[model samples]
Structures are given as structure tokens and as C-alpha cells.
Target: MSEKWDKESILSLSGAFQTCRILLTAAELDLFTILSDGPKSVEDIARDKSWDERGLRIVMDALAATGFLQKSAEGSYSADETMLKLMAKNGSQSILPLVLHRNRMWESWSKLTEIVKTGSNPNPLGMASRTSEEVQDFIDAMHVVGSVMANRIVESLDLAPFKRMLDVGGASGTYIMAFLRKAPHMKATLFDFPRVVEMGRNRLTQHGFIDRVEIVAGDYTKDELPSGHDLVLLSAIIHSNSRDVNRMLYGKIFRSLDPGGTVLIRDYVLDESRTNPPDGAIFAVNMLCATSAGDSYTLKEIREDLETSGFVSVNLIRNGANMDQLISAEKPR
Candidate 1:
């Protein structure tokens, strides 16, 4: 069901990218952090940062116009206290990493028109193709987004029966750390690409779980999984693969699990019509812009794929309005 739309609303929707683009520009420049240090004239900022004065001034003014910054009486610009706290690099509540990742995503989305015409993302960009620094930014961004939801999702499950956990594609080990914190006696194995595993090892060491986690580095799509785990987690991972790849992955996961072990997949599981909770429908476009055949999967599609890999008792275990929907299945005993 579509919301009733008006001409004004339609026009408003068409130009929504203006504010987004302006915000992305400001965030990319680390303007929020600089302004938080102290308000400065555009000349001071541009000269210090070696940026184009004209371009910097225009974006700063646009940020003020968007109510994300304030212009002082002395002709200096600064972020509002609240906005600074959220966007500044060193602020107590900073979400800057996530913003940076979105800037990278903006680059990908810019090719949407060409992708639609070619049926492929001609100049695709993703974590698999990023520099070392950019890879850290992407991992940190995912942690910032998942830190709260991870605990909530873990709290919903009764994990007492599962002693070992395998967190597949676990970026930064955020969910694995959450699981360990919840079940102190449970040891985990985190699997991801080599670069991510190195960072994960560092974080787990800092959090004092380095001894409890066995970190494995390999690509899940074309590699064998480590076996004998009783619980597995695939959080926010499946949407990045085509169905055939997902099936191949599920089969690998199935073979890796202990008998009667449970596998939980947390993602934007769609309704039968493949469009509900609205955001999932829209996120399918994001996948299209990044992957050749990746997409948001309806529960029927997910269940069928899992079943084809020999999973049983598959069902939607949780549902939400955003990307927190979850599905669970078991390797029959």
C-alpha cells in the first residue's frame, strides 16, 4: 500500500539528495571536528586544511542552512553543541565513522543510473576493494551501527544450551563480544577476511577475550568453514550475496555445525511479496548498486535456500520495522 502523495511531497522527495549531499561533503572534510575545536572564519579553515576557500564556505553555509551548524556574530562558523557531539570525530557520542562509510556508499549510488542501464555495477566499490584505512572505517562504522542492536538481539535468545558460537563474517567481533558478555562461559570462533580478523583480534585483545576466541581468516564464499560449533550467527551478511552463493554458504555452514545446532540469520528478511517493513524494499536497491546479483531475500526464498542445504524447522524468529528481522533453522539431530 502506497502512502497518498501530493505534488509538493513528490517535489520534496525529488530534491532530498541536496541535504544529504551537503552533509556528506561536510562530514567527509571532518568539518564537524574542526569546528568543535573552535569556531573559525572560512579563510582560517581553508588555509589550514589546504582546501578551496569558496567550496568550504559554500558547504559550511549550507550546513548552517540545514540547522546542523551555527554562524556566530563574528562571522565564524561552528557546529551546534548537540550536532557537534554526534558528528565530531572526538566527541563523546560521535558517529563519524558511519557517516564516512555513507560517503563511500554515496560514490557507489552515484552510478545507479548506469547500473540500471547495464544490469551491473560497472565501477563497483565495497570493503573487499578498499584500502587498509578505508577497511577500518567500514568495520568501525558497522560496529557503531550494531553496538546497541547486538545486545538486544542476543538478549532475545536463550543461549544456555549452546556452548560454542561461530560468528561468520563477524566484523570487529561486535556480536561475538556481545555473546561472550551475555554468556561468560561460552567460547567463540570468529571468521572473516584476513584484514578484518586482524582488527578483530586487536579489539578482542583489548576487551580481554583474545584467549576465548579463535579467529579464522578466509573468504566465506570460496573457502571451507571450521567445524564442530553448536551455534552460528550470520548477522547482516546474506544481503550481499546472490542466491547461488548463499546456498553454497549455507551448505558449508550446515556441514560445519554439530548435530542439532542452531543457525540464526539476522537481516532484512522480506515478506512473501518481497516488500514490507518498507526499508527492506529500499535496501534491495542498495544491494543492486553494489553487487551484481545481491538482494534482500523474502523469508520464503531464505527458507527454501536453507532447506536445500538440509536445514530443518526453519522459521522467522523475529520481525521488526527495519533491518533487524531474524530467521532461525537447525541441522536436524
Candidate 2:
């Protein structure tokens, strides 16, 4: 059912972007991080950063009004204690990198109208174009989000029969670590681009699970995956590819797996209509804005693609509102 909209609600909807923009702008500016040490006057902040006082004051005021920060009668703004912790750059639990990445996404999302009109991103920003800092932030963003669900998702799966596993496009080995934690005896391979492979090595080494995993560095889209695994994971990977690319990748996964081995996909598995889950519909737009040729896929599309690539017994293992949805299939024995 559609939302019951009246004039007030419609206007409210129209102004939704304003609040998000304010938050994103503040996050991008590192305003929270700046305030994390202590409250500061707008003049103090602007002078320290060589930014315009007027612009800094306005954003801080908006943040204070929105309860993200507090403004005292003395005309200084301070970040909330809890909020500051999560936005602090060096804080272990900080999600600042993810927030900053979304701040970058604002540029792409700003061109949604143009993308819709031209049926293409006017300025497609590919992964290889990212600077070292941006690449680290992107990998950190993926890890921050993946770490939350990886353990839970791994726990739900039956890992008994699977002796060896491969994590395709596994950034920093978040899911691989989780899987290994669940079943320590299983041998594993963590595959990704070379830079990301190094990050995964550090993470696994830090966690003391390095010896159990074999790290392989290669682009799944451009190279064959490492073989001899009884299970494979493609978490949040498929939505970035077009159907044709996913089909070819599925074929690679099928070959990489031992006969009757399982390949589990964790992504936004949309229904036939592709609109049942509102977030999936919205993320479809996000993919369009971010990727050169990416959009959320319906399960039917996924099943057909997998089948064409020689996967069988496709099943919707779990339905998730966000990007946590699961689809499982196998290479025939």
C-alpha cells in the first residue's frame, strides 16, 4: 500500500533531503570529530580549519537543533558523547569511514536525474580510480557493515559438510573470519584485489586465524577463482555486476567448487516485482547511481542466471529487508 500523503506530508517528504544533507555535510567536514575533544565556538572551528565561519556556524547550529550536537548559550557547539564516539576517526567502534563514503556518494546521487535521463552515469567512478586513502575507506566501510552480520549469517548456515571454503570478493576477510570462527577445522581461501588481500591478511593475522586461511589476490571479474573449495561465499558481490557478468561469475564459481559443493550469495535478493522490500527498491537506485551497469536483481533473474551457468537447486535461504538476503545453490555432482 502507498503512503497516505497529504500536503503536509508531501512537503515533509520533499524536505527529507535537507536533514540528510545536513548530517552528511557535517560528517564530511569532520565536524563531529573536531568537537569530540571538546565543544568549540564556530569562530574557533573555522579559524582552526581555515573554513568560512558563516558556513561552519550554520551546519553546527543545524546539528545542534537536530540533537546530534548541543549548543550552549555561550554560542559553542558540542557533539553528543555517544555520537562523538561513533564518529571519532580513531575510535575502534567508529563508523566514520562509512559515513564519509556516503558523503562521497552524495555526488553520484546528485546526478540521479541525469542518470535517469541518459540511462547512464554521467561520471562513472570506478574502483581503480580511487586513491589509496579512498580505497582504504571503501574497504573499511565494507568491513564495518559486514562485521555486524557475518557472524550471525555464518552461525545460521550448516557448515558440517563443507570442509573447505572460498570467499569471493571478500574484503578484509570479515565473513571468512566469521566462518572460521564457526568451524575452525575448515580450510579457507580469501580472494580479492591485491591491496584488499593484504588488508585481509592483516585482519586474519590480528585475529590469530592466519594459518587456517590461504590468501589469494585476484579480481574475480577478470580472473578465475581459486579452486578446490567445497563452499563459496559471494556476499554483497553480485549486485555490483550486470546479469551477464553474474552469469559468467557463477560459471567460475561452479567450476571452482567441488562437485555438489554449495555457493551462498548474500545480497539484496529482490522478489519478482522488485518492490516488495522498499529498501531493495531504493538500493536499486543506489546501484544505478554508483555502478556503471549495476542494479538490484530479482530472485527469478538470479535463478535463471545461475541455472544458465550450471548451478542447480537454487533456494532462497533467507529474506532480509536490507542487504542481508541469502540465496544458495550448488554445482551438480
User: What is the TM-score of each predicted model, taking all chains together?
Assistant: 0.97, 0.95
lDDT of 2 by residue, 275-315 (tens): 86778889889889998888899899999999999999999
Candidate 1 global TM-score: 0.97
Give stretches of model 1 more than 4 Å off.
none
Clashes of each: 0, 0
| lDDT (tens digit, per residue) of candidate 1 on 1-333 | 767899999999999999999998888888989988788999999899899998888988888888988988887998778988899999888899999989988888888898889897875555677899899988989989999999998898888999999999998899999999999889999999998999999999999998999999999878999997999999999999989999999999999999999999999988888878689988999998877788999999999999999999999988897788889999999
Q: What local distance difference test score does each model get?
A: 0.91, 0.88
Clashes of 2: 0
- List pairs with backbone clashes in candidate 1: none
Cα displacement (angstroms), candidate 1, residue 307, comes to: 0.9
